[model samples]
Target: MATLVATPRSRALGFGLRHAREARGLGVRELARLAQVVAQDVSSWESGLRVPKLEQLGVLFGALRVAPPERARLVELARNAREPNWLERSMPGISPALSTYVEYERTATEMVNWEPLLVPGLLQAPGYAEAIMRAHRLPPRMVEREVAIRLRRREVLTRHDPLVLKLFLGEEALRRSIADPAAMAEQLRLLVRAAQPRTSSIRVVPANVGYHPGQAGHFVIFDFAHLPSVVHIEHLRGSAHLYDGDHVAAFRAAAETLSDLALSEQESLALIQGVITGLE
Candidate 1:
């Protein structure tokens, strides 16, 4: 049977150990004997059920035949796995499906987004957010809370070390009136204001651009401070967290293609201003 890896920290460490053991043609029992730990404990570490102490890591490293620096890297990966994300503590009762995306967002140094149906959450004006929520038929209190969360996410725009927010919005998103035309105008203005080069960027994919890569739905690619990049796909009922190399590559390609085909930042701002004027 496959061993269970531990949560964030121990999981990485355990994976490294297992990879090393497999490379050395050793079974779980043999690796456990070399590391001076029980096989079940090793399995638990691999499965993310528990983390390894520093001493335990040293033993694992010895068994894995790793040098000091490589061993340190494995240990650091394990440490990150063990650390609980801020979103886990701040919003305890939220859906589990959202936790991974939130963790990626809070820890990311760069974020790229593409939304076809509505304003991206981070850039949403409060009224726009509320209107969209109402349209979705969320309970009143839930709408308020979701709006609050969206507003809070905007802090990333002005942090001391702000993240790079590159967003692409479909022409349909801009044209459709989520709220009153006046409210939509305000939302468009907000998008323009947020698009300034220093803090954020906005690009519009014109209707003329026709078919494109992100035709299916919205997705976000998060580049974390030190961890691997992640892609988040949201659906009606749930969300998916993708971290494998191949999936990340596909999303990256799509983002690049969209960015290339979409109107430039300046042009997009002009387009949004035109919408605002028409609405007024």
Candidate 2:
């Protein structure tokens, strides 16, 4: 049976397992019979609700005809499936952090984002995103690839049963100057459009709001309908996903703090519009 404590790493491993099975043209029952497990357990493993043991992973991967490289990567994920937090570094064969985050994002029923320095990734306009990526000095191809991926991520916001998002932006984020004024204005405009009644709540935290929990850093909280919540903390090198109760609670408290300090949705919209006026 599947449980709510499935970690993002487990989900990534499950994603890999499902991909490998589909690539080999094996259905759940077909693979389950080959691996000597019930079809429901295979479904549970593929959905990340339950993790198979190391021995079971061997049987499953062997049955799926997964390549050595991918099998090694997935096996590594299974090895750490119970870890409470995941630091996005030194992942073998594939970049599981991106996969893990994307899977969490897609499945999360509600998302609370706090960005002090820039627009949240999901809401970033293409030009604003490209400017930030180029500033990082990423190669042209990588920039294009990331930008395209970001655009795809936005799809989640508008899909059926769209994500219930609470976005808290720092006041300075609206005024910060980017390479292109038009793009910056457009970015703010995007914020205005997305901050409507049925879309999302976009609020701003004034810079002078002395010392708050969010001052420590930016983070995102993803809440799932039938599973445990996950918190994502992004830093200079990479990001970390937190799945344990204490860590997730700390971030949730931070979200509550930001909610108290941020401007009202309407006020935030007015201030954002004012910034757009300044840019023009």
Candidate 3:
């Protein structure tokens, strides 16, 4: 019942390129001639039916006389276009990482997030996000920029047919206040409130669980309408998007085990409230 969907970025990039061509007073036929690519190829790319390859991207960029940084961005986008996987499709531009995150949020039917170190991005309040970003010493403008992006991302929760977000947090994340006590309390209350059946659900893994697979780090598993479940593992340097049958099975098994070990929905809210009280 699951089918793999191409990353939204591919389509967006293709559309951008097409628009760029038209803005330059060049038709698809003209761009194809300039890029030395087939007219059908340009047509397919513009229609989002297919993405151009790396060499093809270079030719197109050259034809447009795109600047170096812009050309580099386009090349990066082309590299991302490879395999038409989430790694390629979910993000298409310079900020591909964040774009990918946003795209997944849009199309996902279900999302399971486990974060061991910090609060999950989807649920972070602006003040809490700002505090964390500041501690990391990001420039003020960058911190503000990321906070804005994160807040915008929250819109997914209110969409007509929103993605079901199931979050599992390590107890330490809740117990350790990232911001001031007042801010932390508000975030804790927010988490508890957000667990309502209609919108979102959250469960906390007690530290007493001793050891668990998620202890290694943070990851998100997404279920898409057209694809089998895929797990996104994030690291300090890079990320791996897992879709292989075996890897997907293992991640799913881990999620099930974690869900079993974590507190039930009602108990989780109680636990959150307890932490909020303890914070004061």
Which is the leading candidate under TM-score? Answer: 2
Q: List TM-scores for all candidates, in order.
A: 0.68, 0.91, 0.76
Every model: Cα RMSD to truth: 11.7, 2.5, 5.4
Clashing residue pairs, candidate 3? 3-226, 3-227, 4-226, 7-89
**Per-candidate clashes, comma-separated:** 13, 0, 4
Model number with the top lDDT? 2
Give a tens-digit lDDT track for model 2, residues 76-150: 888888786788763422256676777778888999999998998788898999999899887888888877888
Task: For candidate 1, write residues 93-175 as lDDT tens digits.
Answer: 34434434554565578998999878888888988898988987888988888888887878877888888888989988999
TM-score-based ranking: 2, 3, 1
Per-candidate Cα lDDT values, in order, are 0.74, 0.85, 0.74
lDDT of 3 by residue, 101-126 (tens): 56668667899898775678788888
Model 2: weakest 10-residue lDDT segment is 88-97
For candidate 3, the C-alpha RMSD (Å) to the true structure equals 5.4
